[model samples]
Target: MEREIVVIATSNTHKLDEIKEILSDFQFDIKSMSEVGLGGLEIIEDGSTFEENAMIKAKTVMNKTGYASIADDSGLEVDAINKAPGIYSARFAGENATDAQNNEKLLNLIANVPEDLRTGRFICAIAMVFPNGESIITRGTCEGSIGFEPTGNGGFGYDPLFIVPEYNKTFGEIPAEIKNKISHRANALNELKSSLKVYLERI
Candidate 1:
């Protein structure tokens, strides 16, 4: 029988669905935190960096459930803002602020800045935790710029304003299939797949 693997750290359904889609090629049964009766593990993200936060969640879940687990922490880093929202992208406006509020605040802050100064990148840090308390980390980033206004309605959060240079479309405007193929999460997942291919084969 194959070993059980779970991604039971985030409450965000969007994140969960995205990860599940990415891991579809794998052989093991993949389950979210709710399916594994781990929906109540409140792993507070108090780490100072993305990698630290990802590890915190991954280790907590791995120790709690004794299963191979994965977690990710991602954010938008604005170069001209000196990475103002690098670790606080989710709560940029406030603790409970909605995506619209966060986007409004970001747009207002950079309203006077030039187009070139609006450059930013989405960064994702993925951490994997094993049953033996060992862990591995990988990172991915997608470069882009923040549009003057939100342009599309497909994705949530800052997607509407994130213009991908290569596609000439905001993340929200691109198909989910296309976005998943080139998003920061996809990049990190590819790295994770490469790093864990051998371990998975042995399991």
Candidate 2:
């Protein structure tokens, strides 16, 4: 059987790997937007919500590649900070802030909040667009609290500061195999997987 060609709208290699791993059960020739000769194709994510941002990228890539495209927008939302840095999680410190810098800013912002009130969650929104101009959107979230300080050096982004209450460990401290199953991105992609199977069958 021939593999279906799909495009993932992201230049980030890590995201591509995670998405590919989750969808491994299916026979898909998943390629990053950059891999499909869409390298350096910058699409502005000016949407106020994660879903809107994900759709923008997905639709852009689908229009360009004429193939099914998947895109996701994810961020950390701290309840103590009024869910701030929601869409700006990547550039919380600045346009080119590093992970460490972003973490520092978040810590300082919530430093005064009591432990019980230091709640937060990781949010992920996935958008899939097909050549037929049809689109599907889904959202997933992982509830947790921000740690007092960074821990472990495993995962990236806010992994070190986001603590899973069930395990009492940061994402950076958890194993990749486990994190891949429970992360916000993981949840969203899993939901998308189910939808994709049915959608593909109908079309």
Best by TM-score: 2
- lDDT string for model 2 (1-203, tens) is 88878999988888999999988988889998778899989899999999999999999899988898899999999998899889999999999999999999999999899999999999999999888889889899999999999999998999999999989999999998889889999999999989988987998
Compute the lDDT of residue 99 as modeled in candidate 2. 99
lDDT (CA) for every model shown? Answer: 0.87, 0.93
TM per candidate comes to 0.94, 0.97
Candidate 2: count of backbone clashes, pairs at least 3 residues apart or interchain:
0
Check candidate 2 and list the clashing pairs: none
Candidate 1 lDDT, 91-121, residue by residue in tens: 9999999999999999998999898889999
The stretch of ten residues in a row with the least summed lDDT in candidate 1 is 1-10
- lDDT of the structure predicted as candidate 2: 0.93
Runs of candidate 2 with Cα error greater than 4 angstroms are none
Backbone collision count in every prediction?
0, 0
Candidate 1 lDDT score at position 78: 85
Q: What TM-score does model 1 achieve against the real structure?
A: 0.94
